[model samples]
Target: MLQAHEADIFRPDVTVLAPQEAVPARRERFATRLSPQDLERRAWKRRVNTIHVNTDVVVKAVARFDQMLADLADDVEGQCLVVPAPSGAGKSHLLARLQMRPSLVPFRDEVGPVRPLVFIKAPSPCTLKTLGLALYVALTDLELSATLKEHDIWRRVRHQMHAQLVSVVMVDEFHHALRGRTGDERRALVETLKNLVIPDPNDPLRPPGAEMRPISLVLSGMPWLRRVLKEDFQLLRRCIFMPIRPLGHSAACVKKATKFLELIEPRLGFPAPSGLSEHDMVQRMLKASAGYTGRMMHLVKKAAFRAIRSGAPSISQLDHLAFVFDEIFELGPHRNPFRVPDISTCPKLKEIEFDKLTRLMGTAQADIDPDDA
Candidate 1:
């Protein structure tokens, strides 16, 4: 369980502080006198830090996914895992966590040090040559010869993979490869990716000195990645499709959401406790965030900042959140979850799907306008 004060905050330099030091330092800073604008700025900065609320469902899913990757690593089978989710559903965040596992670290081998994992984002206009070059750069930190043909680029990539002893390759934003391409182009791109995991036995690029070991692949992207996989039978057969959906409206989901709020409430630096776990408040929050974990946290963080700027001890009622939602989203009272007395009864809430809400909320930071700051 991650306490509110122990939550990871984002730093401009991207250096993370130890939890013990960071929490106290933050509390001390909040205690000092400052201008209202500065206070709001400081409060808003907390948005960058992730509050990992470990619900049973999320924990089990991550554990299962990790176990699958681990199994693939040991066998070196050219199997793949496809993780598809709507934006802000935490797909990227989850991949970031997986990259930190000790099992994925480099280790000593008879030959030398062997890197077990390599993570890279698919190039914007993803092509065989560009993708190969990206992998080459990730492996050797050197540019591939632009003069080389696409096949030659892949040859170098294969050689480097053997040299580094990479067991897993995680490609994020894989959907970029399929964007704006013809059917034939998409098919060619899929084939190129397929060869990366399961190479042709007759290929001339096979490194002579290194043992042939299978490499596992983990690809993550938006929901459209399913379409790309469907275009290639081999790609679909070689991978496991995992779709991460938003938490549905259910008692279990509400319970998880409530617990998440309880954990975050204490860390907001409130002088007194806020009854955010109350049934009505919890329900309102769930409705506002449309049961998306990322959006839920965004709402809480923004509301906390608003409370601090207002000199309030805690965020206690729907009215407090209503102000922040209206200011951030520019939505009318009828559409704002925080402004409505009964979310279910609100016609606007009933009309919009959770996916649309996820898109509307795009980036939580977008809520903070520069002029307002």
Candidate 2:
């Protein structure tokens, strides 16, 4: 060997690490304050961490939804209510709670000896078959012990579902199904929903509206879903469309904001971290967040990282929230980044920011009146 130190056989860096070991370390996939075990227990927690909360509004919405289902079991012929809230308004969270509420059990008792409440989150498959399949999956997920094809599963499911007196189908992410590529796909959704809703020939009861789709539904998604429905006014009129406005700075919103944060805090590292004074920091967070649920969490999550890296011991409140808005959003004093309304005990009207806009002068040429030009 010309030089032992330079020989390829002596390449210490290459020989020391295996290819897999050489791979760069990735950041943990776990939520900020979550222990690894917590994610596995809930199963849905990781998925949920990605969703923001607008609970103050959603609680009331879920209550109304509960009542609607109760009305359905009583054969009250209720029109389906679509709780149309913003993307980050925790629409899915509301849907989850609707299934978990204590009020729901009574509907089952009155409707049948063992009525099962079914909740399905639409999958990305976007076809009728896949949606139907997903519904089956959701049922199984609910611990129904019903397999997809166990000799007359649908027949058994149909009877069992019917006998229970009330089967409420709540589909979160209704928008995915709305974007059907072909008429067949769209028709499939319409038909499947029709089957779940309106009476099938084999169905025990005719759809409430007769011509209307039955099976009480709480179809929810972002604002765009409403527009998608509006494309077909006939179909939309059948729905009880109630839109949830995003939360902005207000007393009620503050309470909601705090509650939501508290829900996540224990998991995200808490007593809300050291610097956070409940009264002062929460208000600051409310202002900085502009009352957008998702954005607020995004800020806090990022702040957690910042705090962790800096060894700040717990990020109660980080000033970086202001930077993200001021620098990235260019939101200055007296300006808000979100379009949500302020909270109020009474219904309030929306205001237009006319002062920020300039109107062009009228285009007509002036009459030649003694050299006015």
TM per prediction:
0.72, 0.53
Q: What is the lDDT of candidate 2?
A: 0.51
Question: Can you list the residue pairs that collide in candidate 2?
Answer: 111-165, 115-164, 197-214, 197-215, 198-214
lDDT per residue as tens, model 1, 136-171: 998888997878998789878888888887888888
Best by TM-score: 1
Clashes of 1: 0
Model 1 Cα RMSD, 1 decimal: 11.5
lDDT of 2 by residue, 32-86 (tens): 6766655443443344345444455566776677677666655524345686654
Assess the local accuracy of residue 332 in candidate 1 as a C-alpha lDDT between 0 and 100.
Answer: 86
The runs of at least 3 residues in candidate 1 whose Cα sits more than 4 Å from the true structure, single-residue gaps closed, are: 1-48, 73-76, 106-114, 143-148, 267-269, 305-312, 316-328, 347-373
